[model samples]
Target: MLLKKLQLKAIDYKFVLTVCFFLFFAPIVAAQEIIPDVVAEKPAEKPSGGKLKIDGIIATVGDYIVLDSDIDKGFLEITAQGGSIKDITRCQMLGKLLEDKLYAHQAIQDSIIVSDAEVRGMMEERLNYMTQQVGGDINKVVEYYKKSSVEEFKTYFADILKEQKLASEMRDKIVKDVEITPEEVRNFFKKIPKDELPTFGAEMEVAQIVVEPKVSKEDKQKVIDRLNAIRQDVLEGSSFATKAVLYSQDPGSAPNGGYYKMTRKTPFVKEFKDVAFSLQAGEISAPFETNFGFHIIMVDKIKGQEVELRHILISPTVSDAALKEAKERITNIRNKIVGNEISFADAARNESDEKETRANGGTLVNPTTQDTRFELTKMDPVLYSQVSNLKGNEVSQPLLNTDDKGKKTYKLITVTNRIDEHTADYAKDYTKIKELALKEKQINAIAKWFDAKIKDTYIKIIGEYKECAFANNWLKK
Candidate 1:
């Protein structure tokens, strides 16, 4: 588990990209020259507020990359988010970063992987939702950010994606397989004081029949040709950025005219990375294919080991025929379910392409918890779209929807239950406590695993951050 304990007055550090100072930036060096000695034993204040700088190399258990720039960027992001920076000590912040890295590093060694599409899909949905929440002025946000354009925003956001993916991978290892026996739940209840027992609610179970609209070969070729045309336009002197802004399907880069960062060995669809790494500085790529569709890439700049570039992706259009077929198939499934012929579970196993939930008997699983219950708080975008208008025992007309993944799909949902807000009980909520107990057990397992790793590994914290507070108690020694 990647645990971050933000003090109520704690300094919250997001993730940052570390940069080694080069002589090219005279101002960066000048700022450093005016600062206190790097060799100082005690923390000192800078001219602007009580900002403190630390010198050190910190490695996660599995040894994922960490740079001082990572912490520095985190500091900037933390302050930008209106965090209480002053009260949080440098060492305290460092500890959070270290904890994140430890889990991220371990996830890599554990062979936990999240797809690039999943990362970008999540990022887009979040941004879109936020934009909707705030009257859709994305431009205002970019300007307020002190970032000149959406390109700069994507650069900052990419770091966010990496940390999120790393955290997600770690969590899968920590919690995905947890199972709590009846005895364990009872024992956990005994441990919880009577007053502290978690309350439950009238939980609901839901089922669905899903159908994904398949893209046609013609649609795919059209996307490829479109990207090829864009590449040609760039070669013919039309601004590639302008074209991207006008037509890119990647919401993250579409508004920015396609400028975003690309780093060596950083996570990206292999095709995109392969095309990107092959280009020299300022080179434009021909159409390249990835699961997302076709992309045209332009290398903006190549810094020693990292490459920064912008790209435009054109999605393969879902054909009308394919979409109709998807809806018709799903509608048939829904009719069968409504008619009460085959069980929804049996239908899901035989027909639903959603591997995540089909195996669970066609029950809607909370993406965050993987539980087959409707959690009002953790409702996914897809679920919200389907369930917001549905009443219990009612089936939705086949909806043209998008899944958590970027693929187009149709959903025929049957809401099993809905309850107005009220207090909860054990008969209805034992599963919730059982889940908590299982999570607690998992945490204990991970803790034991962490201790064993610390005993076997070599770690060194250099320079200013000699003392740091990490979640792993072993770090204290």
Candidate 2:
């Protein structure tokens, strides 16, 4: 739903519909493309100590009541991103929020379930993204939200995130199977006036074959030895938390001194959880290996089936020789493909270490679209720059980068097709135009759904808000 508020230029059909629905209805304010820096608004002064406004129910839809503070919060959030608050804008925001509520309510009736773990995972990802946006300072983020700790902020926003996710899923269900035929796409393009056609930027279908350097057993042993030393130090009275903060490679937990709250039900790797749970409180475990790396865990507390633990993880270093070997391997593979000794797809299928792309013969899928095509602006700078100069069917020299798992690897890129910036065309841009048509169809379908839904659901607006103009048939009753 936050994505619905953002303007996106990429050509993912799903996201195209997401933002398109918002585009169909005029917004209260121009929504910010980035996450707004939400700051709480102090109330207008009434007396010596500025009497705060009491939050009360301002509207109701179905079983849900929209609180005045909800509007205030929305106002603060949108206006923080440079939106202006006025009667019209407030009304528009209320309509959107009501629409969101309707979806959430309907989701409940449909028996759609969103798990707590999924919500928590998404919350963590969003928090991590926010942390990165603040230049990796979690403290600043906490300060921005006026929260004492990261966990406090998570607790505060957890419900909001869950609602947003539920609303999005509901919206997706409404238009999930929306499609447009060739004739529909052609007719849709024809409907666009000659002077008003949308222009698209240069995009490419790029593929890559990756080669990860294998860590030698000797280097793996070195990592094991280092972890053993750290374990010995902890056994000799060194603080496990201090050692973890100093040396643990797991960034997600290292900042908290490798602390985790886990239960048997909590989804941790069996190897990690088993060792963690077996240890007595304040006991340290010997170094053990997981897919991420070698780890030595300390059990801080155990409450029934739940365990509180701290761990120090150390990833084995990939030697320069191994990196060189990876580069050499990719280079040889690239040469073989270029010399026609092997096809690029065959080489990718046989040799690429990237599991996600390997099955598709190294076709790089756009995370948003699940397609091989990508808008150049959306690609990583290194990937874009390397492929920018290459013609269709040309391959790049071996480039070094970390893979999705954060392992160092060497890769070669091939640009299969390139489409330059041009006004939308029926022949050349069928998929793009079809998505646009589908979006319009989705908008109409949703509008009809809303008309029927609002008519059936109970809606009560305060007298003050009743004066504001709403774009929807919200006041039809």
Candidate 3:
């Protein structure tokens, strides 16, 4: 679902996907990636609002004023969930803020620089998300902050983006080269208490042979003819909404006349988003084709980081010939592997397009376990329909398949790996445990680094936040 909306650059998505796999299988990744406990401590009081001097300092860590506005904005963001700020101690959060600033400031002094494009892109993704989370009402968000408009809110958002980016950069730098050996992983697993072990999610092993709705030259021409007629209607006073509601087969949004709030970073097919974003509010898009089908979009509105756009997706039913051809291709590939003319692994690399598995010798890894065993429910329904009973190395008949993001395709899975439920042994799950041990080691290392640096730097907390749940890493000075 997230992939559909956040259609990241393929390379970046692939990189993140690799990390996801590492973390899922390895314990250290989960521990290190979990959101840290955030809190802030108070500092020695300064008399009410005495304008702190501009000595290039905001809130001092030991000697650091974290920018006054940074504190206020941070509060606003977290507090946006609503309710009195009472239950969640503001003082504690502020102390966490101070610690963040201290690290952020240090990052600056160390000459860290964030790319403007990267910062802006992340900010856009987040802002669009916030806008939607708050009911896609940008005005309400602007009003909440009492800012002049959505545009005015960006300066503060940018600062927060910078802080986050800096902190993340620091974290990544510390952990980038960390590694875990199989032996170490085995040792860590040996130390786990049974009661505390993480349980797995449901899994699935699915196969698919897709039957695409192929539009022949004649059928495609008919579609074009119908779309053109609709466009002509729009030009001659017929509404796009009514036509879209009637003809669009992409069921996700056809009911509301085909509009959905969208952002640039989403995983919407590239062509769809590109064409959609290019239109002005009220402009009717020319007919376009995506794997799903043809579409005619209408741009309803555009907020700074988000947009309200709608479209009608019409899928043309696939022809018998197309489906037959797809199956034949799959069969040919499968036969070659069965015949040993080519290895199943090589056949997948050469013939399959699943980037996730192809690079790994076509191992069908469980999305949840990052292992071969799936708990069942996690499998794609269409894919699982075909592979339900096959044993290791057994091939299934071709069945209709769709990618996680819903691009329809076909597949004939060769169930090359299967594992039964069993108690995990360090010998088997060592790769998983090594990850946890590595992260624990890295965290301690980073904590010590921060502790040592605090003594060498000017630090101050204005509000006595020092007593709060500060990362023990920050208190060493």
Candidate 4:
């Protein structure tokens, strides 16, 4: 769909630049003020032998300054991430840098505080990823980034990351309250010429009833006991990180020694947060069960509302008998639905084990669009494979599924709605059309905010950069 394509482009524009900026680490130079109309001096004659050119400030937006080297660094960052700089220019990089500075500066003026702990946690994760990329060699990271040591690299990037975070928060604040009404959605759709109406891809609404293999009490106890044993080892002078690496079943944290920093507002499960917040620094929590598995957490430090901790998770092993039983259960449910003895939605509500879909009568909401319809081309590969061939009210045979956490389940799926490729219909595609309208409204709000801010905020473009055209009025003219 043209609307879908626009949405993808907008998302790429929003995130790609920020990601490129963070990928390359550079030294921040001091700001030097120059009169707005003053032209920067050209370099004087050099010796026959080549000499290094000096870096200087090219532009200043509010309290932040853009360095000549920053443009070069931006190019390097993009190239490092496999992006082409063939069509990119220094002027374009400078414009982006100026925008980011404006946002960051405005954020500080608004007293938007991003805590040091949050920045430090992000810095650590980035550093770990970098080091891992270089074969787990910290020295390679320093050498690749041309830093004298790891600490210097961390310090420079930490400041950069903080500014980036501030800029992001400020940008979000600009359009946070922007909303669109039904009239606006209709008007927005009406503005598109009939010949230009976007064609939506073939899509279908799929529903499923899942039955997870149940873990026996003994199997669950075995997991709890294992976590307890690991906790005892940590208390008796073994490294918790080492134990986590060896035994924790949580793939996300196991490699990083199960480290996580969290506050009360963090999205960790309530059971996990309760146990973590209840423990004092240096105290190890008793084994506890959550939907993911069982975990034993040790609080490393406490800073106000935030706590740094390490945890090891162990999921109970499902017996083959349990898997077979799950398959049989789902198969029976499918047979009942096919035979018309029970309605599919009613069976899901009464018999499905998956809490997420059970209450919704097994209907799946597409994560991307937050709707029931999934565009065939854009659907997740695994889901497409399962439901692609089904037509009408044909219920699929029980299919075994493995989740990201390696949990096993069996499901029966059916397609409730299917729409062939067609030009956008105002009444039928109202939800999608509304999203497009809302996004346009939000973009306008952001543009207006930036226009007002540019006037109120101090900005100066110097030298040859003053000639380059920018989407925004950074020169305040």
TM-score of 2: 0.64
lDDT of 2 by residue, 145-168 (tens): 557987887786677667766777
Score candidate 4 by lDDT: 0.79
Checking candidate 1 for backbone clashes, the offending pairs are 7-10, 16-70, 17-69, 18-69, 18-70, 200-424
lDDT of 4 by residue, 195-252 (tens): 8788999999999998989899999988888888888888999999889878888766
Q: What C-alpha lDDT, on a 0 to 100 scale, does residue 463 get in candidate 3? A: 37
Best by TM-score: 4
Per-residue alpha-carbon lDDT of candidate 3 for residues 41-123, written as tens digits (9 for 90 to 100): 22333234444343233446642356545444443443333212333343444545654565676777777777554455555
Off by more than 4 A, model 1: 1-191, 236-239, 259-291, 298-309, 319-322, 353-361, 377-385, 388-394, 402-408, 416-477
Off by over 4 Å in 3: 1-96, 130-137, 144-146, 190-362, 366-407, 412-423, 473-477
TM-score of each: 0.48, 0.64, 0.52, 0.80
Better of 2 and 3 by TM-score: 2
Q: Which stretches of candidate 4 lie over 4 Å from their true place?
A: 1-55, 79-89, 130-144, 233-248, 251-268, 273-284, 297-311
Q: Give the Å error, residue 240, model 2.
A: 16
Between candidates 2 and 4, the one scoring higher on TM-score is 4
Q: What order do you get sorting by TM-score, best first? A: 4, 2, 3, 1
